[model samples]
Target: MESCGMSFIKYLLFIFNLFFAMSGLGIIIAGALVLADVSDFSHFVTSDLVGPPIVLIVMGAIIFLVASLGCYGAIRENYKMLVAFAVFLIIIFIVEFAVGITAAVYKADFQETLKKSMKKSLEQYESSSNNNIEKAAWDNVQQKVKCCGVNGKSDWSSTPMSCCYKDKMDESDQPEEFCVSGGRNYIYKEGCYKRLQMKIESNTKILIGVGIGIAFVQVVGMFLAFWLAYTIKKEDESK
Candidate 1:
């Protein structure tokens, strides 16, 4: 009955590790996609913004490798490999915990940092020219987010065509004069910074939650691998 129980745990650990391996692969693919898309808007993204995708790629690769170790160690009942897998998992958990704590502690600063970077980008916006990625990014944000300038309409000496109200737009494909006209009230009053900051916070919370959940699962897998290996070792000694 003890041997049977050990075998069951060994299989369970293998399944857990297998699932984690697949999840790691998915993260790697998602990070690669993010990196590729961000490259197109490189001028708009700050160094801080670039770090997440690269970290994701590295963490995913490491998780995949450690999961393989766990799976093989469990299946083969290798005591040394199981111990190594547990040790690696503990290290990863510690690192992830530290990161989470640091992020939480510095969460307020993230908004300020993002706001400064965004304001810098907005100060450089040129509506007549779409030749640069920064201008293109701002145009897209203004058009899609339905917000004008970094703070409000007053930030712009002349409103960009993107901020013009849809109803007042002329049939001409060229830039509308209504956006710049002092008599017109077609410009959006809200700032893009608040909208962007909200989005960033929401995404950050989701990623942190996912990271914590993954780390918890790794901890469970570590215990299961260690237990299974210990059980196998004891059984061998009795024989």
Candidate 2:
């Protein structure tokens, strides 16, 4: 009966290692997608805001490596390796919990910070003829997000070319004037900051979910690892 139970646990742990590894891959993909989405409006945010996603990606990679160690330890019935694996899982759990909390806090302050950032970017945008990172990022967000200025079309001193329908617009005739919502060249009425904010908030959900899911997986992995280690030690002592 003991041999049967031990074999069952070994198989279960091996299977769980596979599941844990896949969870890690999911986190990596989630982080990559969120990072890509953020890149479109990168100029509107400080570089430090990217830290959470990067940490997720790095943690995911570490999980993949750790999962392998767990599988090896379980299959080999190595008590020491299983203890080490449990320790690593505990460390990862703590970090993931902190990241999730950080992300939640960041979300709470996101709107105000984004609004300020957008205002700063708009102030630096100056003109349609001016080419700079702010202009470039703003233009991309306007087109991709189907949004206008910081608040709305009126936030601009004059409507930006990005707010206009490209093919229908005649820059030669009105350059940046006819985009005030009257004709075919009417600008997008929505605000870039709001649109981008929604996108960012939505993406943050993915990160949060990954963090929560990984924490659960880590806890289970730690439990199974320690239990297996104890079982293996017991069997060795009886011998």
Candidate 3:
């Protein structure tokens, strides 16, 4: 006969696994948001910034799958599967810990990179004639961020129409001379790099917080899995 304590533990483990699986979905959503946030700064930063979010998405998928196995094992009182689930939770915890640390360490380096790369990106945007897509993207970013250029209006000898404070003034309606010599009194005064750096820091903090929070939960899960597995093993040996 199963002891009352063991029965209680079994139900508790099942419920915990259910919660873990749901949290996995939350992590995935958090990762997606971080990835989207990185894209907003894509014009200034390299592809390396996407790494943490990608890792989080993959880890969350893994957790969701493992939690299913854990739930099944807990319900069936399967010792082997319970042990496997415990191992997976430990592996996930280690991965999250490593990723969180790496992201924290690289935050300053990435901000420096963003600052250094801005001028080069602006130069590329300016020199390319087939940059309609780039132009539109930049205009959207500029309007949303309310920033003039990499540094200021002075950063552009030919600033885009979006830089001008006039609401939806037609670019073609401008004086030919104004178009040719693109400095305008209405140009947005703030720099984009500074504003974007603040964005990066805020989004990265959210990512790291999610990873750490999930990792701590996994630690609790690992303990329960191990305890339940050991209890089942002891019970079997005595039979």
Q: Which candidate is the best by TM-score?
A: 2
Model 3 misplacement above 4 A: 166-185
**Rank by TM-score (best first):** 2, 3, 1
Candidate 1: Cα lDDT at 33: 67
Summarize candidate 2's per-residue lDDT along 162-215 as a digit string, tens digits.
Answer: 887644443355444345343445567668878887887788777767777788
Lowest summed lDDT across 10 adjacent residues in model 1 is found at 174-183
Best by lDDT: 2
Q: Can you give the TM-score per candidate against the true fold? A: 0.79, 0.88, 0.86
TM-score of 1: 0.79
Model 2 misses residue 213 by how many Å? 1.8
* lDDT tens readout by residue for model 1, 165-238: 64554435544334544344466667777766665665576567668778878879778977987888888888
The local distance difference test score of each candidate is 0.74, 0.81, 0.80
- State the lDDT of candidate 3 residue by residue for 14-113, as single tens digits: 9999999998998899889989877766765647777777888888889999999999999999999999999999887877777677767887887788
In model 2, the runs with Cα more than 4 Å from the true position are: 127-131, 166-184
Q: Give the TM-score of candidate 2.
A: 0.88
Ranking by lDDT: 2, 3, 1
